[model samples]
Target: MSEMMTRENLTGLYVITDTTRFQRAALVESVSEAIAGGARVVQYRDKSDDVARRREEAAALAELCRRHGRSFIVNDDVALAIEVGADGVHLGRDDAPLTETRARFAAEGLDAIIGVSCYADRLRAERAAAEGADYLAFGAMFPSPTKPHAPGAPAEVLGWARERLGRPVCGIGGITATNVRDLMAHRPDMIAVISEVFAAPDIRAAAEALCHAMAADNTESIQTTEDPETS
Candidate 1:
């Protein structure tokens, strides 16, 4: 794994690929642009049944992320993640059990970064943390076009996870540059975005804007914490 993708370094802009929006070559090109624009983590999310095509795209993306020194994650596909030598896998509620996934990685001599989607459920997040999830994700922070029907997770959940879970918390779904500050105010370690970046007219510019916004918020957070008057 690249030094860029350690458990301690799982912060900043996380971009998830939208296969429905881009084809093979376009996907690679868009991801390259996103990385250039400061996307620290890239996840390949394809729910298609075309196994061969999925493998091909994932392998290409894994290599792309490795070349760019970014974390590469396969969404809900542990086998594909292992086959493509991804840095990790992000599992959702319907995905394989975390224990089994860990065992699979251990058997393969890989220390995989596993992220669990807790949606809007704090109890689920607690359970996942207890089960040793490397990161916990909560979402639909706003109305998400990608998963429009996903459960709404209040911004407060980010704060709760950060203060109590002791794991990297990622705020995902419907995050855009304009409303990201609202989520950032709660102090999530990372923010996951999809259509806002991938479906933009200029992928790099969209990604850069999101990164810049988050950086600005982080700076303000640090300053406020350091200044006694603000406390």
Candidate 2:
């Protein structure tokens, strides 16, 4: 086994699974295609409270990502992530405080891969890094159907983060291959896509396009560099 949650795992195309966009039965299949297409990271985001199904799906996706050598993240639910053996968890500001979450995961003997959503706030990003978050996410940089009212981050958020922090900066929301290059100008370590990747007729092709865009910034080639865990 190789390392997981390393800074090296932060770059490239990130695929977020949207339950609304994919039927339950097809979710795993869709995610598999995404990995095959070149998604470096996979986030299992399900808003529904179907615990049984969520666990089942998350577990399946977790195994799939492991098999493909991709990092798997669970959004907003550390328990579910732990249960599924996911590589990490992504938390919104409204979710459990990072310190608490970290302590809880620590109690379970997990160093947990955690990413914090700072929305449009640079200060919050700074705080999250201080709190020991692995990466900082800012956006709805563009209007997003998934989160229509999500606050907008200024175009310079990524640039500012690069100047201010050494950790990875992930640019998300309404991100697509076509428009991703604009955000890429600031050199985001990751580009997170939902509809652009899952809603496309060909999930693999869509992911490939975004993967290509991610690599344009001299990101790691969309090839073998397994193990999200890092030292």
Candidate 3:
């Protein structure tokens, strides 16, 4: 196993790729721009059945993330993640069981950073935490263009998970720079975005704006929580 990705490494902007938005070359270029603009984590989320192409793209992304020293995760494909040596894998409800995936990683001598999608279910988040998920993701924080039908999760869930689950929490779906401050009120460790960054005219600029927004919010949150008298 390479360096294990701890919960501490799960912070900041997390960008998810949309195959519908970009082809292979464009995908690589756009992701490079995102990383350059301070995306700490990148997830390859192709749902197509093209095994060879998926593998190729995932391998390319894994290498790109490795070069940049950013965490790379594969969505819902343990085999592909293992093949590409990804730092982690993200599991949705329909995906493989977390324990089985962890066993597979152990068998392969990889300390996979597995993240579980809890949607709006607190019980499900608790279960995932108990089952050893490295992080918990909740959303459709807003109406997601990419997954419009995805279940809507309230921003409060992000705070709840961070307090109770003892793992990093990610807010995903439809989060953009404009409304990110609203989500930031819940203080999510990371925000997972798709179309908001990748669909923009300038991917790097969009990513940078989001990162800057998040940082500003975090600064405000810390200051608000601190005791001025103590200072």
- Candidate 2 regions exceeding 4 Å error are 1-5, 217-231
Candidates 1 and 3, the one with greater lDDT: 3
Name the top lDDT candidate. Answer: 3
The lDDT, on a scale of 0 to 1, for candidate 2 is 0.83
Query: On residues 1-231, what C-alpha lDDT tens digit does candidate 3 reach at each position?
Result: 136455578999999997888868888999999999999999999989999889989999998988888899999999899998899899999998999999999999888899999999888998999999999999999999988898898887787778777899999988999999988877899999999899999999999999999988875442133233421
Question: Which parts of model 1 have CA positions greater than 4 angstroms off?
Answer: 1-4, 220-231
- Provide TM-scores for the models: 0.93, 0.90, 0.93
Worst 10 residues of 1 by lDDT: 222-231
Question: Residues 1-231, candidate 2, lDDT per residue (tens digit)?
Answer: 114546578878888998986755699999989989988889999989789999989998888888877888999998998888888899997899999999978888887788999888867888998899988888988999888988888657776776677788898999888878777767778888899988899999999988887677554222222233410
Q: What's the true lDDT of residue 142 in model 3?
A: 93
CA lDDT of each prediction against the hidden true structure: 0.88, 0.83, 0.89
Candidate 1 residue lDDT tens string, 109-205: 8899999999988788989999899999999899999989987988877877787789999999899999998878778899999998988999999
- Residue 160 deviation, candidate 3, in Å? 0.8
Better of 1 and 2 by lDDT: 1
lDDT-based ranking, best first?
3, 1, 2
Alpha carbon lDDT at 47, candidate 2 = 86
**How far out, in Å, is residue 93 in model 2?**
1.4
